[model samples]
Target chain A: MTDRRTIYLDNSATTQVHPEVIDTIQPYLSEKYGNPSSIYHKGREAKEAVEDARKKVADLINAEPEEIIFTGSGTEGNNMALKGIAFANKNRGKHIITTKIEHKSILNSAGWLERNGFDVTYLNVDENGTIDIEQLKKEIRSDTILVSVMFANNEVGTIQPIEEIKDILKNKNIYLHTDAVQTAGKFDLDVKELGIDLLTLSGHKMHATKGIGALYIKKGTKIEPFLHGGGQERNLRSGTENVPEIVGMGKAAEIAKKDLEKNRIHLKKLEKKLKEDIFRKIPELILNGHPEKRLPGNLNISFKYIEGESVVLMLDEKDICVSTGSACTSNSLKPSYVLTAMKKDPVFMHGSIRFSIGAFNTEEDIDTITKTLPEIIKSLRAISPLYNKD
Target chain B: MYSKKVMDHFKNPRNTGEIEDADGIGEVGNPICGDIMKITIKVKDDRIEDIKFKTFGCAAAIATSSMITEIAKGKTLEEAKEISKKDVSCALDGLPPIKEHCSNLASEGLRKAIDDYLMKKKD
Candidate 1:
């Protein structure tokens, strides 16, 4: 399905790597192919490049460069942060707090922790997918060692109240970690100002190459090494440094930081226009997530009495890429757990479609979607026995 | 991932829409799983003279609906009753493993329609 006219709106899955990032990494892949650990001039060049990338990533999140540990991806970063802290502070406490709307990485890692003799409390989210601060506060206990929440949800694009959460944990002994994969590049995320103890960032979400991400470990936070090897990443994570990908991520981060305002505006404009047009065209269409505190580019909606998978396939035929709430990966035929957690009706959950707009999309792309989608929904609804096409 | 035949059937489905003046009707699957197929049939003596379908599902569900209707039309009720899920999938080249259940719905819907026809004939 390689259509030159394909409009990719699934940015939450991954982003198209920026040309500047590719340009920045070409030399590292070709000429500067030395290992960062080698004790020679070429190695020193590679080491300097890695450290420079570290600084750039740190700058993107407003963390000290020394506190950054490069990992394979956002999943690895989350694993390291949750398991690392859980292992290191096992003696202090074994209780961890998280929200129900976290990505699979956080939920799975928490599940592992729970299976391995640790206690975890999955805080319930409201209808908008935002966790209640009062519930989180009430859930904190003396043995609670860490609290991990996502900065913003990937599916519904609900921005959590991290700043308020920081205030709740300020006087406590617990460490706060956020899987900031979705919010890192799209928004102005300053870990320092947000009082985030640990932050996870994935390169692929920010127009950088995949397979390279960073974990922000605030100095003096108790954490054991999740990965053991040749004692790399300050003995936290050990692997041969991915020089080219690191350089790509660094350039991407620099560009993201510089273009933050412009990108935000562009995404917001597109999201607003698309939502407005779609709402005007389709009645009884339900919007998911927070109205104001959502990702700028996200527009999730449910077309009642129609299946989201059908809509996705129809849109795919039109060369417009989209995603449905139900994961088409496994044959289980289950709807989105995230939507279920928010207490959405089982029938409506199957109809939810997440249209995550990105920096690469144009107004023309939105126009194509807005023009074609209503007709598609109309046809599907006509065939639907539940829908009365009056 | 759907086969080319499946995509073709989905793109241009045969025997679409509802048979308003029908002899028998069958609806299978549910909206909860994001699939619901309603099959309507017109019977002449013991043979299916016409068949139409309306579906609310993904590509596979609609294609299977179309495929089953095409397989059943002009066939004796006894012969149409023999068309299994595997037969419908085979006719569409093959469906994805996950989507094989859609073909099951297709076969089930046809059988229900035939059963409805038999019940009506007795009435």
Candidate 2:
């Protein structure tokens, strides 16, 4: 280590665990390692810790503790919600509705449901990544039993109209599930007010350790258990509890609830300064996602005539970590499907870079990025044959 | 993931620029696929005396381009054309499986430069 500070702006991928959360989880790891399901005194202590963590998570989301089910990760929570709901309510209906821009967890689970004889209606989004409410209402058929949408997009940070979607489905028999993994700790989440019956959240995205997540199922929502064994978590998910991580997640959630507004304001300021500096210095830059409706910390932009992967590598050299929409970083050889869905041109898709800020970011960090980013883009664009100096 | 040699070349790419007085030039890839390379060669006496490349691609693509130029310089046109995709990738130690396609751009760029040379000679 050269004692150089690393600027990590990839919060959408995962966040660094907070020290407070680490302190909260210390006792649970070594001293209180007993399983929550056991009946002994140690087990009782573990169970109390798990319940307390659950209560904290519930309080953050404004839900009953009974409504939350702990899972292995956000992906698992999404799978449980989509597959469990699809299987449990198959008799009542076989159709589902979701947007084209949901996280892969929900989309892949929806694909699995399709293979099992369920019809899924994928609603399209506009240029800003907001789904069409009129189209969503038109697509809901008599056989539609569930509607799934994301609270906010992970790639572009475009927030969906969760409250509007839920209100539209209020009178219907359909159940509404929103994957709130990206939006959970960043904003206020009242399930009743949002009209969301089911929601998913990941620990690592909100300053907690990985491998621990939760799904909120409102009372009266019918869902079958995806995993069957040991009958833990209301028989919905069965596994030995991850005590330390759960405690960490609970602590993270509590801190997030208290610091949501402050973090939001801080990130917004960082984003504004970074964007203004970048736009002033660089030309042919296009911003992605909804302007005002996006996450406070997200700053996605496309630098034309240069590859995003190249920009990412160059930025990495400076110890500033960021992610891109380039196919080189992704499994597929095509540009980001989220950007593609927004009808972005191929050049913009290939050149898109996402700077997902977080609570830890400071104005000086923004200055460091703005100071280094323009030169990186300028140098790459200089060598880019497609770019014209004019 | 990349090999140490790939990282080395990516960190310090050689012969990167446009030879405005070059005898031949070849460009491959488009912005759509997210990788593009333009090679400019200064050939003299049927020998590639100088070669430069400008690439807009991933770490692998840029490294492979740099490696191709290093392999092509001071070689006869026929010898430079014979440089294979495996040769460029092997020069960089090796590329990840997903990035193997980037090497094709490297060799193709050299061959295209040679082709451009022959075509302009015929004209």
Candidate 3:
């Protein structure tokens, strides 16, 4: 505990809260604690803090402050976007379209709409986790009300063509929503330029506090509120605002905006080096997802004959935390559906590992992984029946 | 990491190819999720003469199936029927929580296929 020699590579899951963000919210947690809904000087201070955070969030996405609505988490934001947009646009269409590789948040949101009398079509992706724009165009019907695809896949890091989606939805009133949880802090994202009508952002994914997120709705977009109560967030979201987290999220957004290019370049360099080393050391490794249409901080590879879960446990013992597509859905029995949808062989699917990098990662960490992974993969593959026996 | 027995079975499994003209067989699991095994057994004179397998599965499934068929070879039908998933996994020196189900399904499939082979012999 005292040594502080830790390497955190699971940035997609979440990040350590920024010290500045913590400082910004400390006073609100202690003396300045007042409900933004209350009418007084202290409450007014809280209200101003909330509004300031709202403005920061909107600024990050290049949207107006009035368009931002604070929510509980990324999942809530996705739900409000999907369900809210679908319910409001039902007079226009009865079908909704999304991809197979969205986060559980968006996937489940689409599922909820399906059960409530709306027909939903889940678009398939190619081996690189890229959806066909033409196929999406063909699927979009007069009855199609919304097209919700994630900006970047959380598991595989495939960047969707949000601009192409925009082009497809140019004339239609169908809203285009994206769950940009993984891409938020890692990439330069502007909702306006991307033509995203509805976008979701999670706080913890970007070094802010957990249990806090926001959704961006275009000025004229009509979305029925999912959580209804007092007129907070323009009567769309109920309950008192978590002023401290909103402030922290705004600070996180500011930090993300300032550090985007530097982190992107650094992580890209590390990614290229790691891939080259992995190819040189373990040449049989196949990189999953799109080659260039992927996140700079994410590297997923499949060691031909070993098991991913075994590699995870071995690396965990060495204090190298990784996941075998270890999503909350089926972290136990199944490999990643994202990889599976990519049409990877079962042998490779069973052997894939996701090594995600973060802001704190260094060249030494990449070197550590490059050095340790090949040996571990070699040992595991040596014992694997697929390699040794067959 | 796994015990040497499990590792060996996984490393150099015996009788891994499929049986084209076998008396009985069973296939279990989906390839997209990893772990698919096709086990085939030949019954002769109330005793299993040959057992073979083909698996597009994880190490544990392939190892456990290879071990089960090894243990079942030349054994009586009733004895092979008594083979359990726990026995298969134990012989391979235990599996991770996730892959253990694959072994269980393999055992269940082996037992079912043998039972089907035996009941057919009665006709």
Better of 2 and 3 by DockQ: 2
- Clashes by residue pair, model 2: none
Model 1 regions more than 4 Å off: A1-4, A326-332
Q: List the residue pairs that clash in candidate 3.
A: none
True contacts kept of each: 0.55, 0.70, 0.26
| Per-residue accuracy of model 1 over A219-269 as CA lDDT, tens digit each | 999899966799888989888888999988988999999999999999999
Candidate 2 structure quality by residue, lDDT tens digits, A50-84: 99999999998999999999989999999988989
Models sorted by TM-score, best on top: 2, 1, 3
Worst lDDT 10-window in candidate 1 chain B? B27-36
List candidate 3 stretches off by more than 4 Å: A1-4, A330-332, B1-33, B36-83, B86-123
Error of 3 at B121 (Å): 19
- Cα lDDT of candidate 2 equals 0.89
- The best-first sequence of candidates by DockQ reads 2, 1, 3
**Regarding TM-score, does 2 or 3 come out ahead?**
2
Error of 2 at A249 (Å): 1.2
Candidate 2 docking classification:
medium
